[model samples]
Target: MAEVKLKNLTKRWGDFVGVDNQSLNIKDQEFLVLLGPSGCGKTTTMRMIAGLEDPTGGEIWIGDRKVNDDLPKDRDVAMVFQNYGLYPHMTIFDNIAYPLKVRGTPKDETRPRVEKAAEQVELTQFLDRKPKALSGGQRQRVALARAIVRTPKVFLMDEPLSNLDAKLRVTMRAELKHLSRALQITTVYVTHDQIEAMTLADRVAVMKHGIIQQLGTPDEIYNDPANLFVAGFIGSPAMNLINGSVRDGMFVTTGGTRLTKLPTADRARAILGVRADDMSVHEAGQGDIDVTIYAFENTGESTLLTVQWGKQRVIARGDRHLRKEQDDVVGISLDPDHLYLFDPDTEQRIRM
Candidate 1:
C-alpha cells in the first residue's frame, strides 16, 4: 500500500470543470472518503486516481512515481464499483481468481489466494454459486473479494454498498470497516451518502460544485464545519438554520423574538444553526422559550418535535417517551456550546 498524492489535479470536459485545481494527500493505509451529492466530482476524482478518466491537468503520484500515463491495470489499484461488476457466467471462486489468472499467477498459488480472499469476506460457502444466484449483498462481497485477491497499491470503492437495502447497507458498512482495518490498504472511497462517509472514512473531504468544501475527520467535520454548505450538507435531518441577527450577545429571530444569547459580538445579519439533538424539549415555560409544536414524530429511538418559532419551524429532539400534540406548547433550550453562527453575506462560519 502507498499514499496517493494529487498535485494541482484537475479535470474538465470542454466548458464544464468536473474537478477544479485541487491537491490532496491520502496517507498510506488511510481510508479517505470523497463525500458529496451527485455532480460534486467525488467519483470523477476517484476515476482519475484509478486511471479510468484522464485529468485535464496536473499530476497524480502513487508513492514515488507519477502515474498520469498509467493504464487502470498498470496503476495497480483495485476498484469495487456500485454494481458489483461480477461476471454472470463465472462462479464466485472463478470471479475472485480472475485477476490473478489474468496476471498469469501459477495455478497452485492462485487457488489458496482466492480461497483466502473469499474466506476473508465470508464468501467461502458461496464459491460454487454463480453471480446470478447470489443476493445483492453476497454479490457485493464477491466484488470485494475480487479486489482483495490482489495486494494492490490502492483500493478505490465507488459507493459499493449503494445497491443494497438500507439494513444491508448498515451491515455491509461494518463489514467494510472490518475488512479495511484487517487489510490495512490505502483506500479512497467515493459516495454521495454522508452516513457512509462519516462511518467508514479516516478523513472525509466534503465536495460541492467540483470544489472541496472541507476535509477533516468525521468528528471535526460534524462538530466544526467550515461554512454554511458543510453545516447543512453533513447532517441527517439537516441543521436548523434560523435567519436572525446577533445583538449584544443575543440571537434575535426576525419576528423580534430573543431566541438565545450568543457568545459572539453583534452582527446585523447571521444564520444561527442548531441541531435538533442539541436542543432539549421541555414542558411549557420550563426552558428558554415557549413555542407551539407544529408536528410530532416518534422514531422509536427518540421523539422529534417540530415547533413554530416565530413563523420558522425548528426541530427539537425529545425523549422517546415524550409525547405532544401538534398544537401543544413546549419549551426549547438551545445548547449554546453547540450552536454555530454563520455569516449570511459570505456563507462562512463566524467561529466566535
Candidate 2:
C-alpha cells in the first residue's frame, strides 16, 4: 500500500562494500524482486530496507517519510524470512496473533483477525498445530499468515521458499504471487533463483557484485538485457556468447561459418549474442558449420542441445522429437530479430 524508495543507498563493512550506491523506487502496491547470485548484495539490500541492517551511507524513504534511523517495528513493514522464524512452542493461531498481542490489541479482536489470516493462507485447519507438526510448506504458510495479520504497508520476503522441495516451491511460488495480488501490498522479494524472479515479479532488479545490473519487467529483462551479465544470468541454459568478429557487415565465427549481421546503427562493431531458444536446428548441410554435439538433454517439452564449434560451446533448445545425440552433426541458424548485440570490449548492449 506504500511505495518504498532508496536514494543513493550504500552498505559497507570496513573496506568490503556489501551494497554500492544503489537507488531504486518501488511503486505503491507493486511486487518488486531483487535478484542475483550469492554475495551479490541482494540480501544486504533487503535487510537495509527492513531496518535490520543499517546502511553505511544513504537514505531510505517509506511512503513520504525518511526512516534512516527508524527501528524495524516503526518502519510499517512485515518480513518473512527463509527460516520462517516461528516460535516452535506456540500454536499456529498464537503465532499468527503474536503481532497483535505485542501491539496490545484486546484478545477478543485478535482471534477473528488471526483466523481470517489463517484462512487466507489456507492454514485454518492447522491453527492448533505446532511448527514441528507442520510440513515445510505449511510452516511457510504460517509465517506468511503471521506477516499478513499485521496488514503492514510493505512486505519483505527473503528466499522464503528456498527451504521447500522443488515441487512444493513451485506450488508456493504461485500461491505467494496470488496472495500478494489479492492483498495489494507493496512487496520486495529477494531471491537468486531467476525463474522465481521471472515468474513472480512485476519488475526484477538484477544485481551483481553489489551493483544493479539491470532493472526491468520480466519480459524486458529476458528479451532485452542491459549487459552481458544480465544477458547471461536471466535465461535458462543461458544465452550463447559466440565470439566472432564483424567483417563486411557479416559475423565470421572461428569455425569459418559466416552469418549476415542484423542491420544496426553500429554494425561495424557488434558481437553476436543469441539465446538458446532463439536458434533453430536443421539437418546438417553444406552451408552449415560442422559442430560436435557435446550433450543433449531432454527436458520434457523441449530438448537442450549443446554443440561445440571449435573450442566454443553453444546451447540450442530444440524439439523433443529431434533425435540428436552426443557427437551428432547439426546445422544451426540464429533468429536475427531475437539476436542481441554487445560491445566486444565493454560487454554492454549495443543499441540497434
Candidate 3:
C-alpha cells in the first residue's frame, strides 16, 4: 500500500506563499495529475512529496510513515524531470544502471534488471550509444528506464513530454499511458497541458494561485465545470460567454434581444455559457438571432465560424463541409439542454 497523503501542506518564503494550505489523498496505484499554469505551485507540491523541499506547515505521509523529515534519496520515490537529465559522458546502459549501483545492488543482480528495463522502453539496441547521439524521445526513455529499474514506491513526473515536438509528444503520451498501467505504481504527475491531464490522469486536481479550484475526473470537469475559470480553461476553443440578463422567464442580450428561455426564475444580471459544439448554425432569419460572420476557419475535421452578435463575438463549431465567408450573415441557436448560467459578480455556477 503506497497511498500518499498531504495534510494542510504549505510552502512559504517569508511573505511569499508558494503552496497554500492544501490537502489531498492519492490512492495506491492511482495515476493522479496536478494541473495548472506556471507559478501555480504544482511543482512545489510534488517536490514536497518527493522530500526535495520542506513544507512550511503540515504533514507528508507515504503509506504508514510520515516522510517530511526524510531525505530525497530515503523517501523511496523516483522523479523524472523535463530536461531528460541524462549523463552526457556515459552510455545509455550506464545511465540506467546508475541508480541501482548507487543503492549498493550487487553487480550480478544489476545486469538483468537494467536489461529488462531497457527492453521495456525499447532502448535495448541503443544501450551502447551515448546521450549526444540519441533523439529527444530516446533520451527520455533512458530517463524512464532509470526510474523503472529500481521499483520505487512512488513516481513523480514533472512535464516529462514538454521538451518533445508536437508530433512526438502525442506518440509519447500513448506510450506513457501504457507504461503506467503496466507498472501500476502510485504516481503524481504535474503538467500545464489540459490534454495531457485529461488523457493520463485518473483524477486531476486543477489549481490556480496555490489553491485547488476543482478536483474531478476529465469528463466531470469538461461536462460540468465548477466555476468560470474551469469552464474557460478546459475546452479547446473555450466556452463562449455572453453578457446578458434574465427577464420574464427569458434570457435577453444586453441589446434587448430575447435569445433563449431562462433556466432560473429571474436574475437582473447573469452570464450565459455555451460551448461551440452546443450551438447550431442556420440561415439568417431562421434561428434564434441573425448575426454577421466575423471570420471562418476550416480545421479539416470541422469548420469554425466567428460570428458577430451585438458588440461581442462568439465562435460556433460548424460541420466539416461548411463554407462561409467574412461579412456573411448566419443565425445561431443555443442548445437549451447544454446551456449554463453563472452569476457575473461571484463567478460561480447558478444551479437554478
Question: Among these predicted structures, which one has the highest lDDT?
Answer: 1
Residue 235 of model 3 has an lDDT of 81
- TM-score for each model: 0.98, 0.96, 0.96
In model 2, state the lDDT of residue 12: 98
Count of backbone collisions in candidate 2 = 0
lDDT of 1 at 238: 90
lDDT of 1 by residue, 1-352 (tens): 8999999999999999999998999999999999998999999999999999999999999988899999988999999998988999999999999999999999999999999999999999999999999999999999999999999999999999999999999999999999999999999999989999999999999998889999999999999999999999998779999999999899999998999988888989999999999999889999999999999999999998898999798888899999889999988899989999999999999988
| Pairs of residues clashing in candidate 1 | none
Candidate 3 structure quality by residue, lDDT tens digits, 144-235: 99989999999999999999999999999999999999999999999999999999999999888888888898888888888888888888
For candidate 2, the lDDT comes to 0.89
Report the alpha-carbon TM-score of model 2 versus the true structure: 0.96
Model 1's TM-score against the true structure: 0.98
The candidate scoring highest on TM-score is: 1
Error of 2 at 307 (Å): 0.8
Q: Report, for every candidate in turn, its global Cα lDDT versus the true structure.
A: 0.94, 0.89, 0.92
